[model samples]
Target: MRIHVKLYATLRRYQPDLPRGAALLLAVPPGTTVNQVLQQLAIPDNVPLVTMVNSSVCRLDCVLAEGDTLNLFPPVAGG
Candidate 1:
């Protein structure tokens, strides 16, 4: 399946080779979960994942489907 991923905030640094704010097209096998995608992208396991699928918030265990658009943002903090 093919999915579009958008990395935001500090998470953008994870893929420095990719154009900032650009949607990345990834080809993943069937039954892939959000967590799996992040792992494949080299995102740290402990990093907080704020994810949205097609504009709705979803869990990391959410299964991905073809044409799914995923927007992922790492947890942000400020005082």
Candidate 2:
């Protein structure tokens, strides 16, 4: 299965050196969850962040489907 990954803010560091704003096409086994992908990408699971799929907030255990777009956002802080 293939999923589109869009890393925002600091998470953009995880993206390969490709064109800007281009979603990384990741190939994972069927039923692969968000947590697994984060692990594979070497993203620290301990980071306070939010994960969304197709614009909807989702858990790391959520199963991803082909063509699904996953976006990761780092925790925001403002005074």
Candidate 3:
């Protein structure tokens, strides 16, 4: 299956070849979970992930579907 991934904030470093905020096309097997995709992208487990699937917030174990647009952001911090 193919899914589009958008990385935000510090997580953007994972996609150095892509323009900031550009979507990346990724291929994974059917039934792949969001967590698996993050692992495949080498996103550190300790990095807080704020994820959205097709504009709706989702958890790491959420299943991915073909044509899904996944937006991932690192947790925002401010005083």
lDDT of 3 by residue, 38-60 (tens): 99999988988899999999999
- Predicted model with the maximum lDDT: 3
lDDT of each: 0.91, 0.89, 0.92
Clashes of each: 0, 0, 0
Candidate 1, 1-79: lDDT as tens digits: 8999999988888888888779999999999999999999999888887999999999989999999999998777778
Cα miss at 13, model 3 (Å)? 0.4
Better lDDT candidate (1, 3)? 3
Ranking by TM-score: 3, 2, 1
- TM-scores for candidates 1 onward, in order: 0.90, 0.91, 0.93
- Compared with the true structure, the alpha-carbon lDDT of candidate 2 equals 0.89
lDDT, residue 35, candidate 3: 95
